[model samples]
Target chain A: MKILAIISEFNPFHNGHKYLLERAKELSDCDAVLCIMSGGFTQRGDMCIMDKYTRAKHAVSGGADCVIQLPAPFAVAPAEIFAKGAIKILLSIPEVSALAFGCESGDEYEFFKAAELFIDESDNFKTIINKKLSEGESYIKSYAEAFEACGGNRDIVTNPNNILGFEYCKAILRAGADIDILPVKRVGAGFGDGELKDNYSSASAIRNNLTDIRISDNIPPYVYNDLKYSADLRGFHSFLRYSLFRAEPKDMQRIIGCGEGLENKLKSLENNNIEKIIENATTKRYSSSRIKRILCANALGLYADDTQNFLGADLYIKPLAVKKTRANEILAALSKSVYPVITDANGKGLSAEGEQCFDKDRYEFAVYNHINGTDKKDYMVLV
Target chain B: MKILAIISEFNPFHNGHKYLLERAKELSDCDAVLCIMSGGFTQRGDMCIMDKYTRAKHAVSGGADCVIQLPAPFAVAPAEIFAKGAIKILLSIPEVSALAFGCESGDEYEFFKAAELFIDESDNFKTIINKKLSEGESYIKSYAEAFEACGGNRDIVTNPNNILGFEYCKAILRAGADIDILPVKRVGAGFGDGELKDNYSSASAIRNNLTDIRISDNIPPYVYNDLKYSADLRGFHSFLRYSLFRAEPKDMQRIIGCGEGLENKLKSLENNNIEKIIENATTKRYSSSRIKRILCANALGLYADDTQNFLGADLYIKPLAVKKTRANEILAALSKSVYPVITDANGKGLSAEGEQCFDKDRYEFAVYNHINGTDKKDYMVLV
Candidate 1:
């Protein structure tokens, strides 16, 4: 039986994510669906739209067999590190046969071609990219222009999910993984769209207008009800502000993804609120999402060295949620996992780095628990 | 010039404190009077009623020629260390001729005899004290009984301020300092009295009844104005709770004064609020003040080893406030002092332990500033 794996934030399991899961199962002819979902923090370097366990429960109720946490510094990391972290988990499990992801273009050949060009770029390709970047083109824009300058497809790297899909392919190629790739076409508005579109509302749309907008048509009922528990960047503002204020430049530069005088800029900022700090830190050189991710990473104590340790490999498997009916089969498959699997925060068998990583997760959860009036012990979701 | 030195919390700078200053001038005929005040954290290991700078300003304006901070872990230590920290500062300067303190019984002879007994405790007296402690007598009770058993004065340790006066004498005697002792009878209801007594009020009375009672008669006009800016422990609850949750047992045990199985009990506590934690931690062996002190020490990162380094002497002299008229005179005296006099939080010339101790003060002020919506850079008080 082939097992299909998906990497996602699932911020709230909407109809688009639902469609992707069903399509993944059909294309891979897989017996089980395994999702490595970003917990508490998201790849955008912002907090989860809702807490991890609620989103995991939605994934299970919507049709996932199991959900594992893609723990930070990967959860709040850049696209490449996020892809590497998720792919590393899949690489460690031999029984996991394929890595499926949703893309707006849904053309695996286009993503493969883009990944190859971007990864195997020569000195000529690098020079064009550097020249474009030096001209103050945005990071993604420069990448797109550089690929186009190299006689690659201009239209391939335009969509957000397709960009992520390309990153996933690059991560797989870099790791020399044997897992097959399955692409499921996204069936809704774009990933960055902040408006509800017919029956396929974007996660951002569902999150921003949570109180007034009825998004039941776009998301499963479990997810709709879990909307009441959704969180934003507000709750972490004061704590992050204090953490940033107490942190010196040297202390901040070690935070994963903080560089290029960003730490100096961050130290000089007058704002303690996350939104205002992000606003102040964002420049042409750094985007808002990138700054948000750096702030979340610093707040969670994720240093560059910690991220480097798990570049193309995972140290542990931390299960966030398990389908109650398929628990036995999932356990049987995971029994042969190459790394230690942790079901709870205090998993005793983790390596020193694994322990440190998990401890950071627990500490972040403790902060979340304190601010949101939740408890850390009840983080596991069963459906 | 016979300069008079006083030690005080002056948590709100009540009229009783004024009485001590006038009485000290009469006794010592001092050219100038100086006060060593606790910073953001007080001797009981709690935040001050107001910011340290504000309190220092009140002290300087009220009558003190200059006000210096007794930086933590000294400011928040128990009686012996508190006395030693204060006396060490006075001992370093030759111009400071005497140590004046408020006492209840007003008997200098009894205080002198008790100080001699405590400072040079005989082997037999030590054995008796240990036996009493082993028999489960309280610390103060054991000390009182041991002194009585050793045929020493029974009346000296009966009053709280008298006991503190004896500790001061003991510290001076142990250090072999030439400083004379001056005792001023407390003109209030009593140190622990919770009721308003004419023009004098206990700090507890003013703090606890700030809402309903008329306290203008009890405190100086400047202190009354500063009352508008007073803060309690409530603001620090969530941050401290998170700090305690993040702290391991070993980490907590390092916090100064966290021993005798206190760290174990602290780790086992379910409450995060300072008041609730203090309530739960209080037992027959420990008082509420001790628990509050422990919690403040832990929150400020004051460790057991930090306390051990300054067991008998302060590492630096930190001046918090100065009267404009006497500023030059005080600066002249401090120039030839045995220890470094630090006027700012970022004092460069300090011993390792001194730096650690002052850093704790600044950090505490940072928390205070964060919670109370103030700034740390504006901490110096000038009258």
Candidate 2:
């Protein structure tokens, strides 16, 4: 009954995602593989290409036994918060003995070593980060530079997955969690690649060029069918653009990632285009992805105070999809779980704050359904 | 020179609107016609067919000496609030001597008589209204029934314009303003008429059957050119539907018109289509238009408390369009006004509550801009 917990967005469940699941089982020797997936919004603040149900079905069809949502707050949060939240849920599951994830580095010890220094969170480390940030480096770059200055492996932080894996390990160490870290080397499709590759195409690449003909080789048959429909982003851009301009500097300060004079810059922008808004809001201290997340949060009326309570740990376990044979097992497991387990998207039994987070996610998911002209009944994808 | 103030939405500046301006000038015998036009959202809670600038330009070209926005809060509010806010602004200007409007009944005494009864707002009158409402009559129906029960002519409330005209006179009486009422008979297509008529089609009719040829006869040459590009309603419908279901019963209660179990009805609805949601939300006690207005306000985050402060009087006077000769005169008149005269959509010098009202209106206006793919520069409907 060895269960491995794999954290993913699985936005469209590309070949690389399938490979990661297979590798998680092979390396961790887990009898059952479960994924904690992002529902509507991804870490980059853009919506997933498809809804959570469809993406979760792809996970089960691909290899996973069960899939639960990573609740929208952390799903669309910054990497540090995203890692902390996911790791918290994984460790809480009781049966999830190991946290399996894909990284550029196959050696798990490499991440743990870096995690040791990063988790220290001493004034010395803060000073180093501030110094790099003051030098006009982006947040990720500043973090990498600070890590190198503190005598850690500088090259590991360059890879996006490795950086996230490091954060996950650090979160686990800080919490003194019992779960072990398992890092699988990414086989193909380097992170951030937006072009098609041999067999393991990057999720972004597949999403960027997703068509009926081009996606078959990249995703499974079920996943390929799932890609037949997608929510129109251009229409959503109007809503986002309206909200961005609607928000005052004070309103921006109340949202995450928009503090520290970012509000001043945003209010000064003259354009209403999303790309242009994000471009103007972006600075050396802030990444475009981070600006997007803040803007997206504002658009959804998700304030900073709403996410404060959920930062330290997972609040609820929301089941999105599971294999037919494993459905009962998953339900039984969730019933005995520590937090409230939400089987329906309505998010019953969640805290007031938790319900707010879930509602934002569900609203975004509803938009996805409206966009694709598809509904929940069509989300089941059999292996 | 006597300034005749005309309150209007001028959604497309149709022949009916032109006739109203002519009738106002002919009856009032004033030198300059000044229109306090609704900006962005109309009283019906729908986005204007074209931007305010274009409509205002048409007003100026047709007969109005100057055109100014009615602001967002008043523009989208109910008839009582709409009438009060527009009259408040009209009275603020020292030179504006008359408030003229189009109505089904050309008799001014008929409107004043109805206004005197309705402005009482006495316990006896409310008891009569509640009695009618207890029978599950619609708000308008209850008002009409109450009017007849109170020894007022029930026929005054039958026509939509007559009812609004009654409210305007009532608001004027309540304020104790010296401005005289000028009532012009509605010459052509009736309110809510949805077909092309002989040179005087309803705005709804023009909007419904808006082909290039069909609209030309209904509106002027410039107004017809404005219709070349139009955004479909489906994009806005997606956002509204998402918000309707996204909100809980309690959340909906915080918005105006969603109280008194309307929130519960909205929450119980399982549909995502705008029409379907409105259909379920509507009962004998609630009309379809009222439901649509509530849903639209909720989607735009306009809450019940937000409107409380603006209910008392006008917050700001904003110029939307002005004829070349009358620009200076309008500016001079506004300079001596009580509240700040806001010339731009940015809403400078407004009170804190005024700012909130302005922001909601501007945000909705931006959505209209994004939907139409037009900018403020094109809003100038020049004479």
Candidate 3:
């Protein structure tokens, strides 16, 4: 079963994502496309516009054959951890022959080369990066500066998709995975663009104009229907504020990515607006995205040691949705994979470690349901 | 100065509360009426209908000469702890010659007798109470049964005000405070009554009929105006849900009043509704009020040890509001009291223990403001 696995957030399963899935399948010539998608939260530290199951159903409806969850610990994380976690999950399936990703740069070789440059860190590179970090630059900014200093293309480190794609390459190389890298160039408004474009709009643009009729053309029909009751950071402001207020600095320090007095910084914020708090907490050393991820981690109770154990533990394949016509074949193939496929919502046959990882996903969904005041159950979406 | 200190929630400072204050002053013939009020939360384990500062202003408007806060650790606690903390605060003030409380019985001697019975526990009484508790009765129910079996009036244990009055007497006796007990008869509606009477009603009734025009007659005009923007438990459902979702069983166990595996009971609930969660968690052993207090403690992150320290520590006279005409006199009196009067919001001039208590109050107010989406600063309301 030649499966082409794609790592995505598919926050709303927009036209751009549809194009990537279709192109990746065509380019890889695989029998089926499997999507390892972020559940409840996106990598950029925002709740998915729609619930994971609905979004997975939309993914199957759009183009994918199966969609498995990228549990919250990794889903609501930085690019490095997010890519590593997703790549590790994909690599656990022995039948996964190729890993496809959407990137601004279509050249896979450049991503691999940049990955190698980051992997084989020289003394000079380390010193320069450390110096830049000490000067209070963001991790990404410091890395970009260091990469440029080491005669690497800074664009690959700066562009969001390119950065993710580079991290994917790094993870694959570090793990010595035999899967092929398939980079399908993103064709639309850029990843961070908030303005709608003709036919192919970025997910951000679609989310910004979710209530606008114009977004109807940018997302699938099912997605368009589900987007009406989408969730966002603003909807979660009260919970976030309460979480911050209740958490002492020591409690917050246990959260993943909350370190170097970030907990104290967050606790000291007095703004009621979520955006304002984020803006106030963001600094040269701590990016706004970093702050958002910390806030999301705090909300989900993603502890540092727990997340570390989750990353170190064996991967679990929990499919959120699969195409009805291909469900048996996908399940049968997944059953034979190295990782345990968790089909039951209660984690019937999962190992202890696997159950712990799956519980985080369940907890994240529970929080999402709570914030939206919905009782949506966790079930595999069958199209 | 013969100051009469009343322990009250004054959730909205309804007509019933106003009547109690007036009658307590007239009955006691005290120089001034000092109110030791619950801040942000009530003993029933619910968020106060209004912020402490606003409620204090309403208390002053309704005839309180001075109002001091009963910190949240005690404010949202069980009757025993609540009464003890409030009594300790009043005892610290040398001018507070008497502690007044509204009760159904209004007989101070009867309350003292009941208090004596509870304090002087016998082996038979203990065995009966333990047997009733083991048979799955609530603490109050068990205590009432044991009291009845020991030739004590069960009515004093069953009635809400009588229960509180009894606890106040017990606290006074335990502390050996020189303050006299002044029990004022409750008027109009009962404590748990949901219907409004002619002009006096329970705080619960006013809260239930907040938007109804009839409630305007039940509360002061300023209170009526402030009631329009009142905060309630329903408004805090998101925060509570998030708190429950983020908290592990161990974390919940550390919360004050969360014990006997109640944390597990709360954590196992899959419901999104706060009311439903409380109802489901409530059993024969745990009353609904107990469950509510646990939920409130969890939301405020009030740990068991911290609250224990707070109860054992020296009291801090943090005035929420004071009648302008008597402000100077009250301030002068309080400054000379045994406890340090914290006039600053920042907890300056406070002992480490006092600051810790004040921080909890500040945190509770912060959570209240976050839930209400308001940035109301904590200030001593004067009118």
Top model number, lDDT: 3
Model 2 agreement with the true structure over B1-383: per-residue lDDT tens digits:
67888888887788888888888888776778889888766777676776777778778888888887776666667888788778887877878888888887747777887888876767878998899899988778898888877777777878888878888888889988887888888878888888788788888888888774867888877778767655546655755665665567777887766788888787666344677777877787788888877777776677767676776534766777778776777678766778787767667788876787777767776666655545554233335
Error of 1 at B191 (Å): 3.8
Ranking by lDDT: 3, 1, 2
Q: Candidate 3 chain A, which ten residues in sequence have the lowest lDDT sum?
A: A232-241
Q: Answer with 1 or 3, whichever has the higher lDDT.
A: 3
Worst 10 residues of 1 chain A by lDDT: A370-379
lDDT of 3 by residue, B1-383 (tens): 78998888888888888888888878886899889888887777788878888888888999989899888888888888888888888888888888788888747777777888889999999999999999999788899899888878887888987889889999999988787888888888889899887798888888888778998888888898876677746557766777777777888888766867888888777345788898898887788988888887887878778878988887588999999988999999888777888765777777778888888888888888877767788878778
What's the TM-score of every candidate structure?
A: 0.86, 0.79, 0.80
Better of 1 and 2 by lDDT: 1
Model 2 chain B weakest 10-residue run by lDDT? B373-382
Q: Could you give me the TM-score of model 2 versus the true structure?
A: 0.79
- Which pairs clash (backbone N, Cα, C closer than 3 Å) in model 2? B53-B379, B57-B381
In angstroms, give how far residue B178 of model 1 lies from its true place.
3.8
**What lDDT tens digits, residue by residue, belong to model 3 across residues A1-383?**
98999898888888899999888878887899999999888776787778888888899999899999987888887788888888888888888988888888747777887888899988888999999999999887898899888878888888977888889999999999887898888898998898998888988888788768888888878888776678755557666776676667887888767878888878777445678889999987778888988887887777778777877887688899999999999998888777788865787767677788888888888888877768788877688
